[model samples]
Target chain A: MSESYEATVTDPVSAPMTCDSNPVEEWLRMDRMPHIWCPGCGIGTSVNCFTRAIEESSLDRKNIAIVSGIGCTGRVAGYLLLDSFHTTHGRALPFATGLKLASPKTKVVVYSGDGDLFAIGGNHFIHAARRNLDMTVLCVNNFNYGMTGGQVAPTTPEFAIASTTPYGSVERPFNLPYLAQSCGAVYVARWTVYHVKQLQRSIREALEKPGFTFIEMVAPCPTLFVRRNRLGDGLAALESYEENAVIKNGADTRECDLGMGGPIVCGKFVDIDRPSYLSNQVAHLRKVLGDRYVMPDAWQGVVQ
Target chain B: MVETKKSAAPKAPKGHVVINTERCKGCGFCAQFCPTGVLAMSKGFNLKGYHPPIIADAAKCSGCGLCGMYCPDFAIYGVKNGRKPESGDL
Candidate 1:
């Protein structure tokens, strides 16, 4: 390989031994380890950055909730120690919106894979961004349906090989950032696993921001996506990310579509403040009721 | 946002990583992500028949913990003098 890291080596098999405390254990469900992800899968990298973002954001852990849809990345909600919900496929966004509206104070985070988010749940995604719900959606775009054995997905780069697309995919891929921006998402960013530091920072920013926020994490599915395509192992995918990703903050979202092979643009494409659903509702109520409608908290006290 | 001190030396602290060898799946993430390139897949194999990474040079480690962040299995973490490397204030 042209890279300079020690990624090409394999030792002879040996007997098992005991392991010790994991530093990230506090953020994880210990009984779940070792996780089901392949040795070099980048999902773990996103999880690491997320936990770090939580730690760095200083948000109250009890008030933070994670919602995930069914997929390989959907397993993230089950792995996290926070209050998390493993929702049905393509439903994490709507589920998170319910949670956010119910408790407004809680920081809801939607974590799921591209297949779950873009393929089936895509409708909810656009509407949520259009309404500007107050929540953060983190999508791990592995470019295929990872849990379903590498089927073609909405985010799979055009012409990439998948189980369903044995010869090559003849479909166009979604430019996620452009979709989110056009739908009025307030904060949007994209990062690959190779950009861990920047990814963590962007996640932290997403967590702290208001209104619908979306961050796309480009990770490797070495087991299915990589192997099926003859791409090298997990680390090789990471090396590719390092080599091909170009960081351009504030780049136009329309130009961020990814392809099978080429320079992948990464950046914070959008960040702006706008009235969220809750805030707009509250404002409308205040203006229309003219002091006749009591605030929900006060009304609850009266009912009790 | 709190600003981190820039007065500190740019070099990372001298650190060592603890590889939970048994848990390692021989991904080489630690070796590949370490900024100082302080680790490498060793000739020895773990129980899973995967090659676990080993510290190639203690002096070269910066204790930045990128390996820990990149590690999908959480089988590795960096420690400097028995404590974690300093993190920016929350």
Candidate 2:
């Protein structure tokens, strides 16, 4: 069957007001433009949403800190022109928590891949969520570890084949949204790169939200996931997301199981206001340490 | 209709279009398609030795993605304000 493409030019649903499209050069390191991610990789789209969220948040860039772990998605820290730390694998959350505790006013963000977050860093992920830290954690779930020769990750489907699993994976994948919700993350949402506008909106909301805000982006890893699964190309995987994903209100984890080949649920799964770890830490510190602590006058007394 | 003092000409949106230096070939398509006298050929050359377009009157930009969509090579992209959700503004 031959496929015909149609272009539709619909009238604006609202007024035709002009808005500024200024290049955010300061926020972006132009040298880092044309990123290192493979072509058709959804990490770029997620990165775009992240940068747009930061721009829209109007947060003080000087006061913002980004922490990332090892993986393809972890490289986001290097692209962003902010106070970022490219830390060891699966340790982004701990470093971000430290930064948040040191400077409560600073906005801390953690960017990692499914392998880094759900595999080796699984323990840290749950503990961090349980603590309700005031930070935005973006976990890019591409089903496999694209950076490390496409190994099967904790989020890989039960039967999906990977480099390590030549035949098929027998182990089931972790349900990210449900795990986060159960672990006590205050805000949780999931979106694919196909839903750019909605993903950007969710990122913005997550940035503004207090406590632990976890966003699981079901990104397309064309190089590994697609090639092995015979899913055509990267654009084909993106089209699949556009066709298979559904944006439903109040959608829960039970309805979006990857193992059962269910519809990809994309929306804000949970959002509730709660006191963050920093605030609670400060209160505990004051109560325990009392007023005995005083700022040192000079760096001479500090020991490395 | 009662005539009031002519309102000052509405200023166009600022910094509407952006050119990706890596993909842009300085084909002058953007300048050709620009309805307003905002974009022009830049004196400097890109890494590829192409004279990329530059915004002459940034204030006159209308945030239209015409240049971006028309470029043979998808070298340009636009991000308009207000239409994008602004976080922490609330």
Candidate 3:
């Protein structure tokens, strides 16, 4: 907490309610009201679910750290009243990994857009999940890169009209839950902003989960994605999600492939138990090193 | 997407919604998906020149807080009269 804006990002449960009427208002940086999210953009709604998820998760706010990379959804880190890291483009996972290693007690949540997470940061995403790090990755998939005038992103569905794909996208979009589940993530889920409560609950579940957890939030980008594709405005996109999204909890991730305006099989696709990376490494080291072992304190008593 | 299944509303008013017109972007998600049809788009516009949602039928609200959850601008929220279904969405 610095003198930059006389507000502290700590202990939500104990802090006095500045905006008693709206509970989520406490978690937001009120000074930054009327965020940059477009009029019909679903990012704001996604953020609402996130703040509510954090509250309902009942986790210690002081120990939770939010990390994000460059993009439209990447701006989420700056708006929330928390210890957040706005890292370089496609570097959010790396920063989050380092943060988790340095402060093992901290809950690292990497919240970024599809382009940031699945495009440039794609390698980091798989590797982090492969190691099963104790972290949560919330990827907002709006089908295309909205901020940069609707460029075709890694998650852009086939036959979609993006700026890069003028006629239609010929490339296949990434089935996010399948990627995370195959990479050994302990928990994986997908939900649209239309399913706000479900998305919030899924996020809370991911927060409480031990190993690597991945949740893809399907949000609509009205300014870029929606308008460019002629899918109507933000409300029309939400309506499509309402019409197409099917809730099938415990469904196979393989069947969750999304096409251009097709059935979106959404649910908790994967939930499996496995030893986390750090704890396993620590246990192995302690056994081999015997009495010579000493725990590493990278934060060096400054973070707490 | 889960709010479509409509059961009969309770006899008495369940909740009331508060709207901050200034921040509303007038996406109309709240009014369209309100399960009980509690809200409608206001004829007037905010400072941003976007029409905000107004509570049209106060008695029909079920305190589900779906409007608050669906609201992208954080401009409106429903306050339940008593305990609510699933609670926890302001």
On lDDT, the stronger of 1 and 3 is: 3
Off by over 4 Å in 3: A1-20, A298-304, B1-12, B82-89
**Residue-wise lDDT of candidate 2 within A1-304, one digit each (tens)?**
1111110111122223222222333455667655567655778667766776776876777878989999998888988889999999999988988877666778889999999988888999999999998899999999999998999899989888999999999997899999999899999999987776688789999998888999999887878888898987666776678788889756876666665245788899999887777566556766788897443233123211
Rank ordering of all candidates by lDDT, starting from the highest: 3, 1, 2
Per-model TM-score, in order, reads 0.89, 0.72, 0.89
lDDT: worst 10-residue window of model 1 chain A: A8-17
DockQ of the two-chain complex in candidate 2: 0.06
Each model's DockQ score:
0.28, 0.06, 0.24
Best by lDDT: 3
Task: Give me the chain B TM-score of candidate 1.
Answer: 0.74
Q: For model 3, how does the per-residue alpha-carbon lDDT over A35-54 read when each residue is reduced to its tens digit? A: 98898899989999998888
Give the C-alpha miss distance for residue A91 in model 1, angstroms: 0.8
Please, what are the lDDT tens digits per residue for candidate 1 over residues A149-172? 999999888888999999989999
